[model samples]
Target: MARLNVKPTRMELANLKDRLKLSTRGHKLLKDKQDELMRQFIILIKENNALREEVERELTDSMKEFVIAKSLINELFIEELFVGSETNVELDIHEKNIMSVIVPQMDFNIKEADVTSDIQYGYLNSSSELDEAIERIESILPKLLKLSEIEKTCQLMADEIEKTRRRVNALEYRMIPQLQETIRYIQMKLEENERSSIVRMMKVKDMGTNN
Candidate 1:
């Protein structure tokens, strides 16, 4: 059973009334917050859907290109050209905040392995097509990483929206009603006590007059 902490006296009742007013105001603000969160969540879902489709398409294309590149590299006779050269690849990535969302930031440097100045076997690189393919791969990598971050952020926001909605619903459908009920009960009890006191006082006065 829920009870309001209303005082037996008028002074306490006045204080309780003020508290009820504040509680109502807080409830309204929380409800508004919940609504705003839900709206944002819906928007994010739409954006995420579009992003997902784009990322899938791009990744599919990238994978196809990757297979072709791999096959070409394997068939290339670059053993003499790559001799004594070292391959050094470095990737530095970090997260940055944007509108409470964390997105990926990346910097990458790639050094060809065993790149010899000899051109005898360098003919294996037959044309700049492989160079272009590698550049595209590098370019698409960051985009994929960014999409991953965005998708994760969308999920996180969705979870937060769900939690906020639950709280709002509880306050609207349960807590507020219970509080109002308790207040009503307290008011009724107080009124009954006042009436009983009045009756007792009247009876005592009548007995004294008769004496």
Candidate 2:
């Protein structure tokens, strides 16, 4: 590795050694964070997949039932039956940190949240299929929200892992090696200077004895 372009002095060597120690420690910590983040990300990905599958499957079934019910009833009457059924959904959004990366957390509450509370039509105007379909759709709402949170968390963690990998690579491949090489070069220069000083002193002593 290439040594740093620094003066070959004892003070510079000490400074380089201190930097190397900090770099090594920081590298290890970043590496560990990357590993743990990967583990958590993998688990979240699996859960996201499973939850997505479940939500999609239920949504598909409910849509089929809804289509059948629509065909069985007059279109305009269907609209009339379910009119003025709007309810406010309160969303509580916040963040949580994982390995120093912030990810989203969301909680929601539907006003007066009984799944069938909005069914205002009389029994004579609706079929079993329509009621069941609406109920199923309502029931899956929370799961859909949860699935969104997991997917978003996975995305954030993936980004964090990539960043940590880059930092670890920088310290491992560049900074640490440069410091070590510089330290060795300075030590060699110091040793050479000590030898030259000893030789000069010995010559002076020999000349003095001859005089």
Candidate 3:
């Protein structure tokens, strides 16, 4: 760390000391905040990994079911069945604060009961595989929404951690050291001035005694 460019004086020393004290305290607090943010970030990462794996597995299963259904049913009929279905989903978004970082929160609401209910198509013509696939996909919606929220939260937290880490490094490596060095220089100058003044006084006193 480079020493600060400052006047070597008692007043400058006092000011620098005060600044050093404040900088040290701020650095400690920032360090603590960074640690906590890392902890939360790690936990979110783990959750994201696990949720991603589970979602992938369920998606594979659903896709397999869909493929089987497609093979067994008429392609035109399947397309018509999907085109006739009406389903609506609403999402509510908000924010929650964690360790000074705001992260997203989401809530999903399905507009109609039929969204998850049995398919309206005639059973005589439609295969059960299609119904099973649709149901499986519908069941995974909530988890998918939750996964989205978690992933976004993790991103926000990671950004905050990086920001905090930078601040802590600035204080520890630059500002605090500069202030300390400046204060030491000022104290040394004051001590030297005091010693010089004492020596002059003693010489004057000895000359007066001889006269």
Candidate 4:
């Protein structure tokens, strides 16, 4: 925090008083904004916690299904197999801004991956279970992506909230107090100066009357 310049004179006292009032008003407004942001941030944190638990549970279930499918495929006769052609899965990426912070957007063409080339290796006619597993994994992908989005947004909001909180505290606890103290100092000096002027005027008047 930078120190405030408080070189005030009687001529500039009115201006300082007005500025003090404005600063106090601005401090109140910023404090209100900070409080609101904190409230929202707390809510977001709780939501993020719930989403994390859900993703963990879903991933556990998915891994179990994956292992079962793999074991079944390995047990099947080798002569009854058909091999499928592989294709590269391309992902499109974009950026979205949330409160001036940029976040990533990912697009996976799962529909394109659905079309598989015929293969010969197993007695089974098709990889229906494997396809189902792939689809399940694909379904979970969007949820995971959504979770990432939520987490990042919450992080950005938290950062802003903390910054706002610091400014509010500085204004409320430090800046305003120092400004008030300076105002008091200037007021006291002006009062003393006024009393001295009155005393001098009375002394000069008495001297004139005597002469």
Candidate 5:
């Protein structure tokens, strides 16, 4: 509550009053924005947590199947099969706005091919476990990518929410109060000046009447 270092005049008081009105309105709007951002951020966090859990569970299952496949197949044969494999995957990145924050959206472009035919190794050479493992791993890639995108979005939104919260607090606690104090100070000064002028006029009239 420090008063602003401004001259105590009618025009200055009027200006301060207008500025306080604008500041109060702006504070309300900013507080509302911060509240909405927090709501949206919480939703994103829950979604990220669920997606992360699902991705982890699928990855664990896929890894277990891969370990079993490795034990059943020749190590050199596994290396050779992967070395000659042809799988094309492309990612297209784009942006989307959530509450004025731009976040990333990713889309996968997988080249068209017969997945069954793409298993280049002979069916007899590779166990069914190996085929299943490969399929599961491939299926997890898109989900993993989606999880990455969601986590990043959550981080960015969290940062924006924090920034907004700081601004709202500053306006609510600091600027508005200071403006109010200054306005009160100016009004008091103007009232005191008005009383002094009236008293001086009364004294002048009394002296003239005596003469």
Candidate 6:
């Protein structure tokens, strides 16, 4: 909106012109980056939403099975059932770069070697409902880990996109305009100075002829 306070000269004008060109080019690059970031962010969001829905559905089913099993058995026995049973899930996390944003790539490792023996309780006393519930829950661990990874990536990308948008807007609305205005002002001043010099030269030549 305002021209920069600079000395009016051809040199200044040339410098301003170069700056304006650079600023314009930078603006285009930043705008393109912002657009591409948005595209990737949207794709991640969609995947996060879908994976979340599926994980929630599976969790609900697992909870239902547990509830049914609890109702059919003695509540005291249910507490003792899983007293000695435990499964450790470990996350092997790695970083991935997406459009300059670093996101987590998660892999879950189940510690127990024998998947079937994960149920520490004796089968004779455990209800079929309990078994199915435990199995389903164990199966969901990897998906849950994956869901976390995607959601985290989405969050990181969203942050990056916001930062990029602000830079683009600053260049487009502020820096570029100010540089262009300053360049124009310098060019006009230089032209006026040139005209004044020509006029002075002509007056001197006329005076010499009159003498």
* Tens-digit lDDT string for candidate 3 (60-132): 9999999988788778877777766765779899889998898888989965436454445676658788889
lDDT of 6 by residue, 20-127 (tens): 889889989888888999998888888889999999999999999888887777766677656646688888889998878999998788866433433345555567
lDDT of each: 0.66, 0.86, 0.86, 0.70, 0.86, 0.84
* Alpha-carbon deviation at 149 in model 4, angstroms: 1.0
| Ranking, TM-score, top scorer first | 3, 5, 6, 2, 4, 1
Task: Tell me model 6's lDDT, rounded to 2 decimals.
Answer: 0.84
Q: State the weakest 10-residue window (summed lDDT) of model 4.
A: 77-86
Better of 3 and 4 by TM-score: 3
Off by over 4 Å in 5: 112-120
Tens digits of lDDT, candidate 5, 16-117: 999999989998888888888889888888998998899899989999999989888878888877766656778898999988889999898766444443
Q: Kindly report which residue stretches of model 3 are placed more than 4 angstroms away from their true locations once superposed.
A: 113-120
What C-alpha lDDT, on a 0 to 100 scale, does residue 81 get in candidate 1? Answer: 27
**Candidate 2 residues 9-78, lDDT tens each?**
9999899999999999999999999899999999999999999999999999998988888788667767
Q: Model 1: per-residue lDDT, tens digit, 9-76?
A: 66666666676687678778767766776676678678778877877787677678756765666444
Error of 2 at 20 (Å): 0.7
**Each model's TM-score, in the order given?**
0.68, 0.87, 0.92, 0.76, 0.91, 0.90
In terms of TM-score, how similar is model 6 to the real structure?
0.90
Candidate 3, residue 28: how far the Cα is off, in Å: 0.8
How many clashes in candidate 4? 12
